[model samples]
Target: ISIIYISSNHIAAASEQLSTTSQQVSQGASEQASSSEEISASMEQMVANIQNNTESAKQAEAIAFKSVEGIRKGYDSTTYALNSMKKIAEKVSIIGDIAFQTNILALNAAVEAARAGEHGKGFAVVAAEVRKLAERSRLAAEEIDRITHDGVKIADEAGRLLSEIVPEIEKTARLVQEIAAASMEQNAGADQINSAIQQLNQITQQNVAASEEMASGAEELNSQAQQLIDIVSFFNIGERETLKTLSNLRNDTRKIAQKTTTPNTEFWKSKRTKSKPKPAEGIDIKLSSNSDDTNYERF
Candidate 1:
């Protein structure tokens, strides 16, 4: 019984050690889990930031494209306006030519009418008015032509500038697209990091669970050792029926105790007992359970 009590004390000490180790491990795991969770959250936030930046870049590209398109349209309208102006100038020149020929015919009619005396006087005056009107029309047409040519030159220069601007804008848009692509890649990388952190957190949780299980097993072993010490008092006479079993039980417990002190030994060796083992000092051996059929450590 004294030996059993000693064994119980050893078990309790072992259990206390195990509990301490388990708590340390659990605390370590908790800290690691918290760190992993924080890292995961940070990675997720990075992914979100990347996504938002990519979206913003895309929007900027879209606006740039719209601006380029607007410039192109303006160029096209200017070209069209220049062409219409040229056509109008051509029509004005045609009108000027017709007026000049009408003025020449009126002068010839006036000369024929002048040979007819008083009738010639009124006819010559009418011809003079026709000549003055034709001269004014010719001057107006020349002025329109000059203005149209200048407008065409300005339109051409504007079109050239538009052409340069469009390509530059296109290049800018491509650059923006590349930036967006890079952002998307960063977002993907962040997601992968977050996933890895989550996996680490899960592993940390498993470690904590394993540590708790180990601690609990040690406490239960300590409790059973105390129970064995109490039951040893019931067999002071060392009954024949329980003598062998008790001997085996003592040998098994001793082996377990040895294992706690020894390294590189098999736990399976705890099941074996010598042919005859003495009862612990000052106590008779008794068995609550047989050692041969039952493996206490298996629990």
Candidate 2:
């Protein structure tokens, strides 16, 4: 029974300790679950954002491609236009030369007409009119040549600007393509992260479940401890005092002997006295209460 009582006491103490530890574990599990849930939510949002950014990057890539194509077309047209303008300038220069030569020929013809005298008057009049027409043509050709040269300068500058812009637009398209690719990679990474977070949440939930089971086990242990205490309570062991020494045990034994041995001792004394002669007159015969006295033999 003492062993049972001690065991119960130990089990109760252990159960209390286990209950505290289980409560702590349960609380920690709940906190971990909450944190995991929060992290999962944040990961989902991040994955969604990554997906949106990937789409945006792809759209930007397409737009950049279109811009590059348009720029290339403009550059090509500018080149063609520039070449045509140069050809027009050349043609205008040729026209100016022809007009100048025509003017010189007309002057020579007029001189010949003057040399012919009466026979050349009509030819002279025609030659003077041709000279006037040639001079006007020369002036008009010079004006057209100047304008064409100006047009050619403007077209050449436009072509040079288009040529310079083409490479930059192509570079921009390449950069956009790279951005789109990187965004796709990032989106994939985000998906992996999201999956990891989900797994973490699952583990956290498992931990929570385990913690709850531990808590229930702790409660059962506590109940067992209480039942042990109740079962031991029936014995009325009172206080659990320690003896610790043989001397103390002897003392307790002597005390119990004194309380219980007196009746037997009195009966023995009466028997011995009755068998013996009575003391005479005023002399009294008294028995010693010294419990350790073993000198007298039993009757």
Candidate 3:
């Protein structure tokens, strides 16, 4: 019985250790899952940031395109203005030439009248006014030419600058578009990472639940072990012959006691006191036995 009790205790301890190990593994799996979930959430947030950046890049590209378009329109309008100025200058020069010819004819008339003395004086004064008007017209035409030339040079320079700027702006737009595309790809990748993390989180939850079940199982095993210990505490069989001897003794004693029609506790106690005690650990046989047989020996 002592050896059996020791073996049973060892079995219970081993069972408890196994159960504890199972629970620990389950808990570790659950913790790992939780860590994976955290990583996944971080990835998801990063993806969201990438998406936002992509959108911003796209918007910047659109603004650059609009700016380039506006610059091109301005260049076109400036070129048209330069052409108009050239035409106006040509017309002014023509008017100046016509005025000079009219002034020459008036001077010739004035010279002819001068030979007539007093009669040509008024005509000479009219001729002088005509020459002055012609000179003023010529000066105005020259000024117009000078202004047109300067305007053309300035406009040409502006157009050249605008042409250079257009390509640079286009390049910037392309770069921005590329950035947006890259950002979009990054966002997609992040989304995938996040999804994987979510799956990990789900797996972790399952692990946690499994761990809880394992712990519960361990508790149940511990309870069962305790119950087994309680049951084992009642049995005594330190030796093989000791069990046999105890059984024979119990049978004879019961036979003797049953001979009396009324079996009482006092008679049973007296019989038990008369018999030599089996051993320190006692024996597995009960003094009275029917269908149910239970034996207990106090320390």
Candidate 4:
């Protein structure tokens, strides 16, 4: 009975401790689940931001490509215009040469008219007018030549600038493409992280469920321990009743020994023997009932 009492106390204390520990574990698991969920949400947001960045990078790369293409086209047009200006300059030079030759021819005609005397006076006047026209043509050609030369120089400068700009634009496009690729990689990594976080959240939820089960088991164990304690109390009460019965039997034996002539040892022994069987039977029945209750609780 003492052993049973000690064991019942131990079991009750252990069950209470287990219940406390299980509650703590359940609370911790729930907190972990909440934290995991928050982390998963944050990861999802990061993934979305990464996706947006990837898209923006792609758009920037496309714009860079278009700018590069436009630059190349502009460079080609500038080169063609430069060539055309050079051709115009050449034509203007040719016109200037022809104008100079015409001026020389007009001077020679004027000299010939001066040699032909009064009949040549009218031809000299015509020659003088032709010389004036030739001079004006030469002056106009010279001005055109000067303007064409300036145009050619300007065109060449524009072509050179365009040529320099083309390579820089291409480089920018390439850099933009690299940035886009990096952004895509980052986006993929973010998605992977998000997946991992989601998996962690799921595991955390499982842990919470397990912890809750453990807590429930602890509660059940505590109830079983309470029942065992009640059984132990009953056993303690039975032990007290057996002690009182033994005390009463000893008093009766003393009275019987005083009244009888024979020895009281056999009587006391017989009564003790008979009383032991009844308590033993009662203890067995109680134990059997307790065992059945324990088995039922376990099931």
Top candidate on TM-score is 4
Candidate 1 per-residue lDDT, tens place, 193-230, comes to 88888899899889888887887887777677666655
lDDT of 2 by residue, 145-197 (tens): 78878887887888788888888988988988898898889889888988888
- Superposition error at 169 for model 2 (Å): 2.4
lDDT of 4 by residue, 43-113 (tens): 88888888888888889889988998888888888888888888888888888888888889889998999
Candidate 3: TM-score? 0.70
TM-score of each: 0.60, 0.73, 0.70, 0.74
Candidate 4 regions exceeding 4 Å error are 235-299
Give the winner by lDDT.
Answer: 4
Q: Which pairs of residues collide in candidate 2?
A: none
Better of 2 and 4 by lDDT: 4
lDDT of 2 at 71: 82
Model 4 collision count:
0
Candidate 1 local lDDT, residue 213: 86
lDDT of each: 0.76, 0.77, 0.77, 0.79
Report the candidate with higher TM-score, 3 versus 4: 4
Poorly placed runs, candidate 1 (over 4 Å)? 1-15, 56-70, 90-117, 218-299
